[model samples]
Target: MSTVQDYASRLSDPGSRKMGTFSYLPPMSPQQIRKQIDWIVQNGWNPAIEHVEPQHAMHSYWYMWKLPMFGETDIDLVLAELEACHRANPGNHVRLIGYDNFSQSQGANMVIYRGRAV
Candidate 1:
């Protein structure tokens, strides 16, 4: 008995979705992203980057930028991968997804980064 309007309203609610450490906030800067990656590494989680064409603002199923960085203690390497993904997929939506084997096998954290407008 839910109508299309109800679904649309929920989808449009900014508070309904939470991405990584930020919610209803602008994209984080490179330094902020590096800090987050460092935290994830400290917690013993693996990080990976993915990207999508971004036909919609909240599109999922992004393609992987490269293999997940497991046991990678180098924050510079993670940042480098992020930059590489952004360079290769300009105008697309990129995300950093973390995996925690201690609890969930995948998607421990996720942050979306909008690419430059074409």
Candidate 2:
């Protein structure tokens, strides 16, 4: 059996991790995320926001901020909601998720927006 120290030695350093669309890259700025959201909206995908504790990096689930924004195209509203979620869950890892079923058939796209540690 692997000891806690053994696991700790095998684990990579704690830091922001990449997921979906822009994996293997640095975290995107708010403006960059806004552009991606806009593009997804233009492509007819619904947007949703979710977050997770940084320490729970390997966990498969995240807490949803609000229901998916179906048919909503205004970027400001999304940005506002994202900001609110960040404020409410400071030090957590927030994400913007998009879903499209008709055009691309892909159900999800995700991007991380790391929150400042309080």
What are the Cα lDDT values of the candidates? 0.70, 0.72
lDDT of 2 by residue, 1-118 (tens): 8754222221244353445547555567777887887897887888888898766645788888989887889999988988888899888878777777576444655645664432
Q: Write the per-residue lDDT of candidate 1 for residues 1-118, one digit (tens) a residue.
A: 8754322224455334444446445667777788888888888989988887545435646688879987887989988888788888778767777788687676455555665432
TM values, all candidates: 0.72, 0.74
What's the TM for model 1? 0.72
After superposition, which runs of candidate 2 have C-alpha atoms over 4 Å from their true positions?
1-12, 21-23, 103-108, 116-118
Best by lDDT: 2
Q: What local lDDT does model 1 show for residue 71?
A: 87
